[model samples]
Target: MTKPTETGFSAPEFLTVDEAAALLRVNRKTLYELIRLTQLPGVLHIGRSIRIRRDALLAWRPGNGGPALGESR
Candidate 1:
């Protein structure tokens, strides 16, 4: 698990749909498509937003995983 620095930013973190999409470098729709296909991992559906755990993303691929915004197969 990752812990936040003094600035406070780390794993188990929360990101907006747009932010997550950006992290994956894809558009929001594409991200949704990935979610629809169940290709992305560790995505949580909160009341109104789709969230991905930062640690999960990091572990999936160290130093930037490939297009992980979408759900995983």
Candidate 2:
């Protein structure tokens, strides 16, 4: 979950690529492909590492009558 700080910036709960892939029920490679296609939410790059927000992954359900992670609200 993300928490609002005194500076008004949110600190989102970030998950590793492997963890995110497991939550999406897809392999890591597939998740990477989705990220590449812009269908999935983009990763947060911290130096040489990448991370995804857990909330975004939870919101990404296709055919659920709602927009996906990176879609416009």
Candidate 3:
């Protein structure tokens, strides 16, 4: 389920790679690197598309310097 924002509009709980990258303020390549480094929480699967949770991204704070908590496999 999505959460309502200041505008009272909810955003999807899961975001595509492009949407996640834009929200993270990083290029797609960098986003992938972060996922690979396990610095950012990710949902991955074989023969399936990848998705990032909005809550995880919202919880992430730049410069905090810690691995995000979430299942990445």
Candidate 4:
């Protein structure tokens, strides 16, 4: 059974870089850069792979005080 998320909808608990990038309408490289800079939250590093929590992504917004996308920290 699918569980309701904080966003009031059901989504995958984790998202791959490509999946996340698509959702954010950004390039995969840009997403990687955000992850590398530790700007985006809820990043999980599993071996050589990376995963992002859907709830965290849904909660994130530029107005939340995070750096603007593509801006250097």
Candidate 5:
């Protein structure tokens, strides 16, 4: 059986900077560095903060063909 979460606030698939860093197995600072260098994509700027789309991250994987969210490659 699975245990229920206590926080009650569910996390979104499209993660914020901190959350995306954790998912990508990189430090948040490193992610920022990547953004500065333009090594990565999906950088949506909604003010002073940067956000990476979950779909974009997943599509960047090898052989994915860079499709939109929920679209089969």
Candidate 6:
């Protein structure tokens, strides 16, 4: 069973690129770059669309040890 996140989304919930970018407070381009580099986790390709798992997105940290959340990158 999936647990509910603070946003009321279940752990298994999928978020669009816009939604995921908004949650991370980053621009869509940045998110897309991460996707392009295969840095982001839980990325799913459905047809020509993309979906990211809410849980995986929330748990992700910059693999390169980039700036902390809420700080300028």
Ranking by lDDT: 4, 6, 3, 2, 5, 1
Q: Give the TM-score of candidate 6.
A: 0.72
Better of 3 and 5 by lDDT: 3
Candidate 1: segments with Cα more than 4 A from true spot: 5-12, 61-73
Which regions of candidate 5 fall more than 4 Å away from where they truly are?
1-13, 62-73
For candidate 5, what is the total of clashing residue pairs?
0
Positional deviation of 73 in candidate 1, in angstroms? 11
RMSD values for the candidates in order, in angstroms, are: 5.8, 8.1, 5.8, 3.6, 9.5, 5.7
* Candidate 3 least-lDDT 10 residues: 64-73
Ranking of models by TM-score? 4, 6, 3, 5, 2, 1
- Going through the candidates in the order shown, the clash numbers are 5, 0, 0, 0, 0, 0
Candidate 3 local distance difference test against the native? 0.77
Error of 6 at 22 (Å): 0.2
CA-lDDT, candidates in order: 0.68, 0.75, 0.77, 0.86, 0.69, 0.84
Candidate 4 residue-wise lDDT, 2-70, digit = tens: 468778987788999999999999999999998988888889999999999977987988464766767
What TM-score do all the candidates reach, one by one? Answer: 0.60, 0.61, 0.72, 0.74, 0.62, 0.72
Residue-wise C-alpha lDDT for candidate 5, range 2-68, written one tens digit per residue = 2234587554545688978888898988788767766567878889877787767767653444443
Across 1-73, the per-residue lDDT of candidate 6 in tens digits comes to 5678779876647889999999999999989988876779999999999999988998987764765333555
Structure candidate 2, residue pairs in collision: none
Lowest lDDT block of 10, candidate 2 = 62-71
Model 1 lDDT tens row, 9-58: 66436666687788878798987876776666778988876888765654
Winning candidate number (lDDT): 4
Clashing pairs for model 5 are: none
